[model samples]
Target: MIRTSLASAPLRVLAADATPVFREGLRAVIDRTVGLEWAGGTDHADAIRRGVRTIGPRVVVLDSAVDPTCTLIRDLVEINPELMVAVLFRDHDRSPASVRVAQSSGARCLLSRDTEASVMVRALLQAHQTGRYVDPRLTMVLSRPWQSASACDAGVLLTARQRQILALVAQGMSEPDIARHLDLGAATVSSHMKETRRRLGARDRAHAVALAYHVGVLPLRPALVAQRGISPVRPAHTD
Candidate 1:
């Protein structure tokens, strides 16, 4: 319903950035661009979630500097499923791994910090209309194939419903909250969760979450930066 009305309106674009220059520049550019309006800028990821729900922006331009770990995109998407996130990556951070990290964190579009003003504006419009836009300069990076090392990247796939439910679980949402959020009955949500746990070979909800992070099916919470890449499970062979 929110997105349906935004189709004919000037879709609002919020900046999940704290930098003065970047936010001001984007605001100025968006003000002049047709079919796009500047919603506002958020200094931290916490405020981003609030703005996303209250402001109802169709797209969010998140600066990598503000969210270096790229964890906020997934949470924002959970708040508004229709939202599109475009990460503003640093020029030096152009690599196949970096692209995959951003995509895995739920960013649908990528833009370089040094990208031309005109190109950035074009990308925003493209994301709003078509739901994606990658920086043309990064096209070569995509040519390299991704190596599958984790279960998530291997053959393991989660159904859309399972992924959504698991995401809510990752945020520490209770089953009832998830049910209300997704408009599913509590029992239905529980059933999907049980299946997800079984698929991951998790013993419980907490175990399911840990395995989800291990498999790259979920991104690490920003607070757990120091623990990044450290699996919670110890290999049986280690014994």
Candidate 2:
């Protein structure tokens, strides 16, 4: 099993959700978990912003329904680029659209509302340390092969490492996280990201991920599942 070396420091985390019940329960959960601390909790996006600034937690876990847009997530990241973010989603609400939204919004980890407290804490700690978390179910999603541009297709040419980085980006790891995972420098990751945006005619990282998905370079995990044994889904616009 893949594992990250444990950090000597306990991870500090901030929790944000409009629901009082969820916030309290999550706080309790994290307090009981090892190597994690519940810095504070908030009920509004503005309050979350304020709390994160005040406490300077290593990670912030937000309720997905509370902030569904990419703009809001990006704003939070801009508030503190070093803060790792996780989104709390409902199990009944899992869908391709939701997954896409979560990725576009810069959430490195996702926890189902039905998830156990222990699981939630574990996920939070993972994000705090590695900048990415994949629950057993989501891990399956992450492992699916991303679509590559067609052999004859000409606009963008991505090297093998670039393609791997694209997949990690689609999985919502920040530039530094990608650098850490790939053992490359942050500057190198930034360079590859810039090239991806330029080659795919994308405006930003989220846009690049969307373009990759739409153009068939990264097929939704379920879509690929349904096609079992058939010819692989071609990258978009290949024909």
Candidate 3:
């Protein structure tokens, strides 16, 4: 059953699709919805991260075909763990492999590339508020899942501390704040972040977030729209 919650605040949303037409079309649908702030849209993963951090949107919708790699999801979650990611897959070829990849990267909702605007809006609102959404069809497939964890592993073994750091980073915690929370020196935290990036082959902080999500190291949350004229929610203050 899909659980519903009354949002105490508004949800800010950022969307990215490789194509302008798709982005615009989705934008129009989302724009008409109440209690949502369209925080702008982009095509690049790096740009998406920047927008999320700066805008602090609670939900992000992405195109799976354009940004199919796990890195796309991982990076978003790594930088904004609280942000929910919704993905649209092409209806013609909604393969299980693609669905699993999307889920592994923390996509809360997966819809057919051809999903109707109303359905998309409903899914978006659900994901934004609760961090979980499932297409009935996709849920049936996931129900059969029994793969060994090793089979799903990507070989990016992380230390326990590294995992904690990645999760916090995904939650949008600043490096200094993470250091303070971890009770470690800022320089040491910096070193860890640098090393983590190097190991993930990440190009930058945003890239690191993408790479982490790509590898299933982080997961997307629910999508929530902010009320009209209200500011979006930021990650909880770590100070």
Candidate 4:
């Protein structure tokens, strides 16, 4: 089958940030990437609302500048229930506590502004397909004592091993593959996966990945993935 290009893409994407430069950067990424269209972007929340209503994009890459607390994710979702959002973490709002709040705000994807373009694309695609994703780097920040205390005072924490296993799982790695990659027996990897599920209270692999997005521990570089059979979900919309 021929690859899909952005122009023929069934769904569009847009950027929403206060900075003109940031919007341009997103536009560039969208222009260069396949499977997405640049539906244009805005610097205001109201404009973003209008754009979503008008453009009806499948995904939006947003900056916390629209709302420092990242509450806008929920509001944007309210406007278009099928829309997926990937939040950019500015220096000011990249704290573990803020990131946690943003992730908790139903943000499926959270990545630093400087994350690689491929990661950004993967994030937008991931959230669009699965409803959850977060840059694994953010997990380091959240693992800190102060960050965890502030973000998840409930004290729900995953060990580094657990985090690594979950990250591999998110990469669509199988138990044997993960075991081989990590230089561990298949049983060991299986045990770790089970424990991770228990810690995250996930019903299965998919649920565990979704919950990992909540705790800030999946999807990032240094852990490569071959995401196969990924097809975007384009919901019906009215003109």
Candidate 5:
């Protein structure tokens, strides 16, 4: 039997894919899986909404290529925050913009269509429990240095102290806590934070952490990749 830590009933899963053959194949996989129940599959956004309302699935697997912006994913989460959304994207669609859209829209996980069935199931299960999952491949992609010719070029680098401070911040440490841990005064910590933000062009601590991860400064946390991109579309606000 498939060993699972899931409580109570099997996890209910719904899939939305524009291609009929692909949708049926995914449904078949879910049906054969031990701890998953194939709620239903749909090719249209309207039908997906109806299926969620009728089937009351705990997880929805969405095709990012079909719904690039993940508007439906956002709508579903808005309706039920407890519902986990796992997005499947084509290899070509795996751009920084796509990642940002998936993150900002509150998608629990992002996967490639070629992802193995077992891995996909694991991602779904992890997303249900932790509310987030970043594919290791995506982590590799995000951790690479940027090649874009933007204001913040690939040559931009963080000092050793800045990297250390960012790593602590990524671990959810407060400025004061980081000061105590590093044997530095609050003022010194605050000054370092300010300079970090300026150098990374981050709007706040969370953005700084995201930038650090994107630039391969801070290690990637498989459970939680910052939803926002290095330079998010919207103005960054304090989290």
Candidate 6:
């Protein structure tokens, strides 16, 4: 069972953002927070991994602009499943695809870069305590009902192998990397990707992932919804 209580000590927080200014700014806010500790910040994924090993923070706030596919987020969580990941996305960068990728990769929270300090703090606390926190803004996107039955039907056309490839794609894996990981040929991986896109009628890989979430091929965890204190929005009726 997952532990629900906050640690007795201040929750140690680390940040990874490519921008030096933004990284330090987050570090300052974390340090100033009452029950949080600023473990450190880094400007790259490698450094972030090194920092994680060195500081052992309970939560890591990642700038999605730096790692848009959330591959780093997935890698970090794989290293330590208990480590809460809070992804920060720039305003224009927010989309169903990015949100789905972060969620699928085990991110505990998603917040905007310009989110209020108070809200960030709450997100941090909630994520650490409850194991999930989706931004209220993105909840609507996640809850949107399929516009047509064909969209839902499209989901069933994907083979299990196709689904596996798409899941990795959502996590931001390159075709070659995915090929290597799955022990398949790179050309075969490409073929599956193409077929998956065709089956979903997705314009691109990202669109495919967004559609996956929409059609229930990639499900949003119940804890994500329960912790947010909101019900899933009902689908609009099409007469």
Say which prediction, candidate 1 or candidate 6, comes out ahead on TM-score: 6
Per-model lDDT:
0.71, 0.66, 0.67, 0.69, 0.73, 0.74
lDDT of 5 by residue, 13-50 (tens): 98899889999989888887778888898888878888
- Deviation of model 3 at 79, angstroms: 0.6
Q: Please state the error at residue 172 of candidate 3 in Å.
A: 33
Q: What is the C-alpha local distance difference test score of candidate 2?
A: 0.66
Error at 95, model 1, angstroms:
2.8
Which is the leading candidate under TM-score? 6
lDDT of 3 by residue, 1-239 (tens): 12224356546778888789989987787667666657889888889878878888888888765565555776778777777888877653244445665686678887776787777777878776666787777666545432223125523345567768877897889999999999999998888888876555454566566545544555444331121111221222323
Error of 3 at 115 (Å): 1.1
RMSD of each: 14.7, 16.0, 13.3, 17.3, 14.1, 9.9
Model 3: ten consecutive residues of lowest lDDT:
224-233
Candidate 2 local lDDT, residue 199 = 58
Q: Candidate 5: misplaced stretches above 4 Å? A: 1-3, 147-239
Worst 10 residues of 2 by lDDT: 146-155
Per-candidate clashes, comma-separated: 0, 2, 25, 0, 0, 0
lDDT of 4 at 98: 61
Per-residue lDDT of candidate 2, residues 62-151 (tens digit): 876666443456667777878788887665334333444465556788767677776766677677667788567655543433223332
lDDT of 1 by residue, 88-186 (tens): 877545644455556666688898888877778777777767878888776666554432333325234467788889989988999999999989999
Q: What is the TM-score of each candidate against the true structure?
A: 0.59, 0.56, 0.56, 0.58, 0.61, 0.62
Candidate 1 error regions (>4 Å): 1-7, 145-239
Model 5, residue 12: displacement in angstroms? 0.9
| Candidate numbers sorted by lDDT from highest down | 6, 5, 1, 4, 3, 2
